[model samples]
Target chain A: MTQNPQITPEWIAVDCSATQMRATAMGAAGPLAQATGETSKDLEAALLCLIAPWLSAQTTPVIACGWDAAPFRAVPCMPADAATLVDIPTEDARISLRIAPGLSQTNPADMMCGEETVIAGALALNPDFDGVICLPGLHSRWVHVSAKEVVSFQTFLTGELFSLLSQPDDTLDGFDPTAFEAALSETLSRPEKLGAKLFSLRAEVALMGLSPRAARSGLVGLLIGTELAAAKPYWLGQPIILIGAPGQCDHYAHALRQQGITPATLDAGDCALAGLSKLRGLL
Target chain B: MTQNPQITPEWIAVDCSATQMRATAMGAAGPLAQATGETSKDLEAALLCLIAPWLSAQTTPVIACGWDAAPFRAVPCMPADAATLVDIPTEDARISLRIAPGLSQTNPADMMCGEETVIAGALALNPDFDGVICLPGLHSRWVHVSAKEVVSFQTFLTGELFSLLSQPDDTLDGFDPTAFEAALSETLSRPEKLGAKLFSLRAEVALMGLSPRAARSGLVGLLIGTELAAAKPYWLGQPIILIGAPGQCDHYAHALRQQGITPATLDAGDCALAGLSKLRGLL
Candidate 1:
């Protein structure tokens, strides 16, 4: 939709993940229009694809998060508006773009890009919320939150490992829940066996005719379960909210359930939008 | 070396790995001629690339191993003359082709292809010897041998994991030995931390300015160390021998040395030839 003289978007919220970038034209009420595209294109071109139609004579401030835009803010700091926004110059005349930096931790070096904005959104939505927030992705992040501050965090390449070892792409369907749970328990209990466990999956197929569904599910369970074992310090005995895509969150939630703990879930895109809006309001 | 009338090859030994195929023409003394090519080529043509010149009017047997050639021979059986030679049909009139079967194990469900032949050769070279044989590869295999029999074996996809997580292919050079040792020790003690440990390598690179050599070496160490932790049952209280490419065997040997265990090393292709020649002698 071209700029409707009648309705002007106050600002646009953009989230640039490692693979893709998305933008939403936000009015005072909510999102007026949205556009999504790959990050592989020229960054300016990608941004214009969304905001060109919405551009007005008045500079449209674009609050963006992701793509490792700026230096990370070390943790043990408030999650809400944690980063100092770095103003990014634009080629377009009417676009005023700014990027929110990601977060980092020193002790066991870890970092997060878009997730920090999502975490900021979560903290802004529920200021009193304190505990753990897990964002599952190619490299799943487990974060500790207390009194609106991100205490510490850890990252796991489990998602990446699963994809490479198994299908290289996974989904919600075609996974055996039973196999998933069994694998979850296996790795959680005997994590050292993980080295051999992955190969055993192939052998099982060659020897036992393990179904594709079972193998995929088992891979998901194994990697997540191993992550849980490592992140026990962050997750166990702490309330958790998994903020990510629904399908992965379902698996994380189920895996946590097996350990007698249930985690709340939130859509990452919504949280990112909320975060951008919240950060914009502060500006 | 085109069908040399002076040095007639009695038979040819071919070893086809997942990615490449190699053949060595054997005379009464030793290898008469050798050639290597990609397995992606037609299997018969790849074999003929080396054997074509050596081919004479008289039938010259080609004893081949690898490429999961025939059905696997289950273990708790002698690695020596373990598999029945599966007669393979060949298009070339002078090519009398046969493939030695690989080995498989029940319970944990594991399998090995070309490495089985290497094990046979190791045993043939030293009859009445018994212990554990570690054949490291994309899928490293650890075999338990007693009285010339492969009692049991386990496979770890650590090499595959390292490739997927860090570099898809690795070699001996450009790795920090100190970093490697530290990572190996850490994983050997706390294997559960592997999920986080992988990311820490990236974090270390990002935050700590870890060198490429250090990161690559650390990854190699961490994966191998964790494998050692899992295969403790196989290596503990048992004499060990590592058979693989020199670069990989060096890393494995060093990792084992850290645990107060020293493993003998051998060239995998050499062992494969020995096993094929020994098996050929039986025929």
Candidate 2:
């Protein structure tokens, strides 16, 4: 019997947000080891704790992306052709850390902190893929990429609203697809009715004893339906790709399919690591 | 100058919600004395405390309108024409308490616990006033009262959403009317973009250092603009009445005036009392 030897990573990539931070060890092929932790008051200490095992005596390049970057501290106006990186001077000389700059738009006055990396990675994967990319998360971003340059983008607070509305440990039991589709369709056609429709969840529960799964699906459908209507111009006749966790992407894919559009899915973590990889080349 | 003599009332009108309870002493003309208190575990005790000075030896009728009633416990299905009142069956023999029933709709599965009293009061003010009545509160209600009957109504979680988004004790300092009108117009035209427009409030604050007053007005404008878009059917070409606290009603009126509608304003507490006064006549 024989055992294959282990391979070491060339660098490390970390994506930190207000709520969570994820670190991935990058190898030549892809991600090797990954760690995640809840964002704490001391994020740097938390990041070091998660990636300590991967840190070595040698000065290894570690690229970080998310809210910690300079671009994210304020409203950043990065041009479509802008590819800038900000180095985070670390206390330990052995660890070389740099953060990727996020993208911002002026007209709508919108900004994105973390999802820019995923868009970068998606763009890297398909250099010629010029279309709209949907990244679902706490603050979902719908980005428009053309000619290998990131153009304007919009951010939707769909995931944040859902989290605020649902219980911490809430989980869907037996999701009803019919309910979800119906809500999605109705909301898409009449997005303005959202302010009134949201409370119906409580009404249904109080009156008909709506199941947890049905309620969960209904909430998600309403949020996504409203998002789709706003982002209609972006996905009207463009190739669309969704990047997020499997569950999040599944919901988005289902909603888009209901609108007669088929979108390809990409792993969020991999895209983040891949985006950091692309930024590594620029650095 | 001679002082007007104090007048005693025959009955008391109370409006109780999940958060607070308001009581009004009804004289022959209108409300004479008003009292309010935060809702506690013992609601009946709280109600007694609020109206203790007004309690008389006689079985003074206390007409209550709020979540304390049976229909509010769960999803109530009271028809538009169903103006039923339930007795509170108080332990106090000197108190005769009865609660006004709320209105519920079936198609959209909507229900209101406290605002029905305001609608009833508005109808009582003008029996032939066949138009829409906008009740602004935590769950703002847009009610249709045709021929003194509640044909249908809708509820928007505008106030609730604003509370969740704002900090506690947050006050708008020097509210910018121009900014609010601009946002209201923009959102009314593009209501679906609300999900995206909301996050920009945070971005503008971070990037541009937006004033709290402007930000507050923007949030209010976005919410009310969306509500107006949904309730357009109710207020368009109709004689509208705004029923709520002065501050809330002012905002509704300002928004309506932007659309060239001058809605008559009515004090919510007085209207609740007046509604109870009308119900007392029937009893």
Instruction: Considering chain A alone, report the TM-score of candidate 2 relative to the true chain A.
Output: 0.89
Off by over 4 Å in 2: A1-9, A27-32, A72-83, A167-169, B1-10, B25-32, B52-60, B72-83
lDDT of 2 by residue, B157-238 (tens): 8898888777678854567787788879877999998889888877787677888888888988998999999889999999
Residue-level error in angstroms, candidate 2, position B5: 18
Which has the greatest DockQ?
Answer: 1
Give me the runs in candidate 1 sitting further than 4 Å from their true place.
A1-7, A168-172, B1-6, B168-172
**What's the alpha carbon RMSD for model 2?**
4.5
TM match of model 2 to true structure: 0.90
DockQ of each: 0.85, 0.66
Model 1 Cα lDDT, one tens digit per residue, B1-283: 3456565689999988988888898988999778787886578877777567777899988888885657888998766572488888888889888888888888888888878789999887777778999999988989999988899999999888877777646454676899999999989999988988889889989978988889999999999989999999999988998999898999999998888899988888889999999988898
Q: When superposed on Cα atoms, how far off is each prediction in RMSD?
A: 2.0, 4.5
